[model samples]
Target: MEHDRTRTRAWVLHPEIKSDEQRRVPEPALEEAVALAAALPDLDVVGSEVVRLQRAQAGLLFGSGKIEELGERFHENEVELVLIDGPVTPVQQRNLEKAWKVKILDRTGLILEIFSDRARTREGVLQVEMAALSYQRTRLVRAWTHLERQRGGLGFVGGPGETQIEADRRAIDEQLVRLRRQLQKVVKTRTLHRAARAKVPYPIVALVGYTNAGKSTLFNGLTGAKVMARDMLFATLDPTMRRVELPDGPEVILSDTVGFISNLPTELVAAFRATLEEVLGADLVVHLRDISHEETEAQAQDVETILTSLGVEDDRPRLEVWNKIDLLSSEDRQATLARAERDPAIFAISAVTGEGIAPLLSEIATILQGARHESTLSLTFAEGQKRAWLFRQEVVRSEEQTEDGFEITVLWTDKQAARFAAL
Candidate 1:
């Protein structure tokens, strides 16, 4: 197609070959992608169609005949970009772009692009760039725009061909190492801050949910912070910590983190682990859900899967928050609420209207207390250092001194309890 480089059209292609599966791609996922794309300010989606291609041409991705047909269609429709809803090998991406004479983005590449566009914070941007560079290290051949060449590192092999590929890989490896080190520094700093907070030991409540499931909105509603609560995927990429007061007059840090998605890229999960450590270290995890969506159950499953993958499955206190209840029909909402009542951890509420949210916060305050360990400690008055240590290490509600030893009652987190027991 002869469109301007800035003016591009997108086509979502789903290859349906001879397979046991009924459909090459699920219709709902495609519809979701289209809806997501329509929400984007840039990049117009001109056409979308499904096609069947020979499995024998898997390496090049599409048969030569199909390539010619797609090329003709693109030309006729003035389409400039082809968005494939499946993974495309670097060779396949290059071959298809060459044959079709248009820019091509596979599912992974398009997702990376979306993340690259959405990321705002320094850490978030770095994580996305790291993923992009890792993905680009392999596709060094096809990504070469002449303009980018002028800027350097243009193609799969910028200047030295395959040698450039090795160099790019090495560069990406170094960058990843650096990023990890930087994130580790951040982690250490956070740990120190958490240690300082441990002197008071207010409970921490973490919000974790599927992308666009209204976590940020709920967090803002609870904390009264304008933390960019937009209705977009990964709107809150950076973790935001805010103090929220409960009905019992106790306040806690409410952390809002990056949203989870189905088939979330493993590389991203690993890259963003440092940020997710807040969730792992939280006193309680609030799993938000868009109760109105048809895929609410599936989305809940996806959130749990991601959390389990992150290794927070066992013993972490969790609460289910069925958000967006206002979007559901009255009957459906009532039925869902009835079902939710049967689950011990589940609560249905609209984050917008604050329905059922006060009780949820009260429950959180109650659960936060249960997450701690109550212990009575014995220490000598001579061991004032130990008393100071106990104060520093555990959340002591009261203390008393004895000739034999000083007995102090403390509420500790799991880790702190372990430390106190060891001492």
Candidate 2:
């Protein structure tokens, strides 16, 4: 027998956005939610509306009358699920569900569900599950009513009318420990691979941008690696790193990280730290922007905001690459070019047509070479390890093996030279 389908009613509760900033809040999220609701196989989205809640009552979220009206509507319309467009606190979520007598899901929950549905890799699944579990731990009370129920196995179990908060916390803590252990293994393996790459010391360039900004296309164009490239939000969740060569005699490792989005969940940011380490350690950061996007400047600012949070804003050399030039008219293209010329660090290019990549790479090569430090240093033959370390870390200019010692002349970063000097 087929299970009964639940009627899902969704409404957007956007935090007061002025008309000016409405463009920043893409309609794709709502559209995606509608599509997801339709494909759920269990729920039907019957209606939706945008409600503006007052800031003071933001805790309860909806006003008392609004809550009563919505609850009545739920009863009248036979709504079994309520989808909220903003974050809902644990207490508020529980209270809302009790009032409406329906399952409630916040914006984070919806996004998590989408990610769960789309995740294909084992690592991606694990990361998403970890984030979901973290979120669920806070709202366990919403899922169960018999908090007074006690089990035989444990002295710590809740008794008569007691909340399951403690037990839920304990359970979540245990899972967190396990997840950390598993993620640690992944981190260790990634570290080993990174260390191995250090022996060859190819310059690394990383691409960072807002979601669906054509990073994967540029990556495929540059490296000839086929990764999933789609014109959808969060199309590529897993970071893909590939080897690329610039014509100016430098081999590079180019990495494309998961795209950033406005108001990305904090849990997601924390869970994906390992994946973003590639950006943190890169020699050059190519900040890709979608020139065709209507909110292109704002999108660029959002990427910079996230990068700043990652502590990469000031230290790393960056190239602002405005992509999708093919979509622009000749006048707009010339305007973009003129803007790029005014900013020495920015370049405009069409990743689709492969135009302007050559100059961008050449500029990057120059920056990478400038990052190297040229210095004269002396080392004893017995310190073969240090000599090898220098070779492993940087391009060695010259080396001589003598009866007493090995003499080397090298170009390296000042940081690396300091490391050699300390030895």
Candidate 3:
């Protein structure tokens, strides 16, 4: 299989629409798109450019002269695939592909391809498949010549005159239904596992950031679990959790989740919500930023946008983890350290060399400490099981016996308090 693989020659283009209100700076966006194209193993990026546009043309997405010029570049470079850095309508995609005589993939399509290639766990694979099918269902336009063919059906079902497009759409819909059913079962099992974890006294701390922002590296450093840590985009597709013990704090469940990207497809965000439940349920979320990157602030904004869309409560405890400090120059590092010193909410650390890790851990312990509260409760003698459970959890800081019942004071987290109430 490895020997049979052939790399496709690809060209990436970022459209710079002057009238568009939400466009990022063209150069960095183009660089990011090129990196996205390179993330696929079987793609050799031949060239990339930022195409200036006053406004998008509905039919072709670019002016005729610009289209012809890009076509010439594609021909000169022998490009087999063209990746657009933004959304392209179905009609525009079809027309552009015909004009350039090469396959065309919009930003959403490119992301789906990368996800399909990188998905590892069963749930991740299923979610990617569903998202790809949802995206494909929308692109079932006149792009393919085969869509002009007519398919034969039963007499009761349109009498052998169904267009190929209808048949294909129906097939995709059927597949989506099957995939949804399978996903439901998988999600049900996952929910059960999460419930089990909720019974434990450990708090969950989830690591989230943009792709290639050193989240997996930090996770490995803190938990000593060998997850796939690399400088590649989407290197860690599935969520990985491990038990981590802090110096003066209780053990915690540390989770490393999929990285967020700018303009992530809505289908993907919806499909992977279940995979990101760890982040939503986390007692503390650590926003790990690659402080060395030029667009670190913009990347952090993208992460926050996605988190907001995922319904992460605004009041949830959060910490800003400025990772990759080792990549900074001495002067820049000093500035970062100064900034961190002034802001108790931020911690600058290098996951590779373990620099500032001890202090970061101490900070995490402090934050977790803030989540705990002490409460006094009165339970009757009949509630022996609940009493035993509380004692087993070692949360019984103080206890007293009264005439009506035994009064107990327990120092515990909100999760523990909820569990005790339920009992």
Best by TM-score: 3
Compared with the true structure, what per-residue lDDT tens digits does model 1 show for residues 1-423? 355567557777766666525443466567656655554557788887667654636567777777888889898887778888767788888888878888888777777777777677666777788788778777876355444334344565445334444566677888878977876676667677776665555678889988889998999898899998787776777789988778884678899998777765566666667567778768889989898887878888888887887889667788888989899998998998998899878999999999999889888988876566677878876877768877665377688878798888887877777765666
Model 3, residue 294: what's the lDDT? 94
lDDT of 3 by residue, 1-423 (tens): 132238898999999999999899899899889888888989989899999999999999999999998899899888899999999988999899889999999999998898888788789999999999989999989545663487567887645878878778888999999999999898888877776676566778999999989999999988889898877788788899999999998788899999889877777788777668889878899999999999999999999998998899888989998999999999999999999999998999998999988988888888887566678889889888899998776567678998877899876778778888888
Q: What is the lDDT for 72 in model 1?
A: 95
The C-alpha stretches of model 1 lying farther than 4 A from their native spots are 1-8, 15-25, 35-41, 50-56, 142-163, 370-411, 414-423
Q: lDDT for model 3, on a 0 to 1 scale?
A: 0.88
**Per-residue error (Å), model 1, residue 7:** 5.8
Q: Output the lDDT of residue 228, model 2.
A: 74
Over 4 Å off, model 3: 1-5, 143-148, 156-159, 369-423
User: Candidate 3 at 287: error in angstroms?
Assistant: 0.8
Each prediction's Cα RMSD? 5.6, 5.5, 5.1
